[model samples]
Target chain A: GIQVEQSPPDLILQEGANSTLRCNFSDSVNNLQWFHQNPWGQLINLFYIPSGTKQNGRLSATTVATERYSLLYISSSQTTDSGVYFCAALEGSNYKLTFGKGTLLTVNP
Target chain B: SAVISQKPSRDICQRGTSLTIQCQVDSQVTMMFWYRQQPGQSLTLIATANQGSEATYESGFVIDKFPISRPNLTFSTLTVSNMSPEDSSIYLCSVRTGRGNTIYFGEGSWLTVV
Candidate 1:
């Protein structure tokens, strides 16, 4: 099984601020995904980046697969973005995903 | 992308009881997964359900406790049998579609044992 690590266990930002979250994996992965768990406990899919970069609205993500790391960028953060952000990866032929502990983000008005 | 729907979004049960959670996917898939998210903890993979085959359980989970059924390519069911207080957690069903291998999740079934 592969290991996933997320940095900045906690974060607080004012509305309209920007922040970056990083995820590092112990081994190469064939699939990588980012999710935001909202206050109501909904796991919202943010990105499915195995390599290169992708942007969705005010959020963006980059995965450097060769280096076994990924970065998620949140620009103009809103209070609605307050939740736990998680990164998960699946390596090789494994169907199971290894998840990071998640970074708790709180955006205040 | 795939649309996943789960039944009984939340429930409360007594110890030693059993509950079955159903997962329905809009499109056919080869693999379906069940994950558990304990309170204040990260998500952990419970088992992988493949069509026409028995599920592969994780290290801490077993077939007797969390029996899973994959009767078809588009549907699966996970039953928490003889559960206890420690079994209370949010159980989610997920799958990887053909579109770039993007994994999608259901809303999850939140269970509480008293």
Candidate 2:
């Protein structure tokens, strides 16, 4: 089984600030995804990046498959962005998506 | 994008009881997965449910404890048997559509065992 590690277990930011979250996997992965779990307990898909980079509004993610790492960037953060950010990697051998413990982000208004 | 709907968004159950959670996908999906999120913990994959086949349970998870049924491509059910307070967690259902391998999740069923 592959192991996933997320950095900076916690983060604090003010509205309009920018922050970057990182995820590192122990083995090769067939897929990588980022999710935002709102206070209400809904896991919202952020990005599905097996490789390369993708952007959605103020949020963007980049996955370097060869390096076994992924980064999620949030620009102009908002109070709505305050939640747990998770990075999951789908292992190629077992095809199981393993999740990181998550980074708890707090954006103060 | 697929629309996933789960029944009994939240519930409270007594110890030694069982509860079945239902997962319904708006479109036909190739793979469905059940995950458990313990309080203040990350999500852990319980099993992968494929249509017409027995689900593949992950390590630390067993078929007897969390039995899954995949009757068709669009629906599935996960039953947590003989649950205890340790089983109190948020059970989530996720699906992978054939479109591009992107996975989407339902609202999740929050269960509290007392």
Candidate 3:
């Protein structure tokens, strides 16, 4: 089983601000995903980056699998971005994902 | 990508009772996973449900307490047996889909035992 640690347990930002969230894993992973749990509790998949970088609109994520760390960047954040961001990783051939505690972001207008 | 639909979005149950949450995926998948999110806590894997075989429960989770069924490739069910206050949590169903093997989750079933 792999252990995931997400940093900046809590964050507050004004609209239009930029921020970065990080996730550190204890072991090598075959799959790494970033998810946003909105206020209504719907878990939205933001990225499936096991390695390299990807961007979707204002959200982008980079996973350095070799380093066992991933970074999520939010650009020009908006109030709608307020929620808990979680990073989950799957080690080896395991089908289950180990999740981090998450980074709770509050983007205030 | 797979679209997951979970039944009974939220429920309130009395202690000693049991509830079953159904997960339906629009596309076929090889493996389905059940996870629990306790109040203010991160998601934890309960078990891995594979079609045609018994589920593999994770440490701290038992088959008797959280029995799972994967009757087919597109559907699965998870039952919370002998419910108690501590058993109350958000139960989510997920699967890996597409070429990326990206995982997708259902909206989740929120349960509260009193």
- What lDDT tens digits, residue by residue, belong to model 2 across residues A20-49? 999999988888999999998999999999
Candidate 1 lDDT tens digits, B1-114: 788999879999999999999999999886799999999999999999978889999999999999999999999999999989999999999998766667789999999999
Model 1: how far is B93 from its true place, Å? 0.3
Residue-level lDDT tens digits of model 1 in A1-109: 7999999899999999999999999998999999999977789999989999999999999999989999999999999999999999988876678999999999999
Interface RMSD of structure candidate 2 (Å): 1.0
Which of 1 and 2 is ahead in lDDT? 2
Q: Candidate 3: lDDT of B26?
A: 94
- iRMS of each prediction: 0.9, 1.0, 0.7
**Overall lDDT per candidate, in order of appearance:** 0.93, 0.94, 0.93
Candidate 3 chain B, run of 10 with poorest lDDT: B95-104
> What TM-score, computed on C-alpha atoms, does each candidate reach?
0.97, 0.97, 0.97
Instruction: Give me the runs in candidate 1 sitting further than 4 Å from their true place.
Output: none
DockQ of 3: 0.86
TM-score of chain A of each: 0.98, 0.97, 0.98
Per-residue lDDT over B2-111 for candidate 3, one digit per residue giving the tens place of the 0 to 100 score = 89999989999999999999999999887799999999999999999989899999889999999899999999999999999999899999998645667899999999
- Per-residue error at B73 for model 1, in Å? 0.8
Q: Candidate 1 falls in which docking quality class?
A: medium
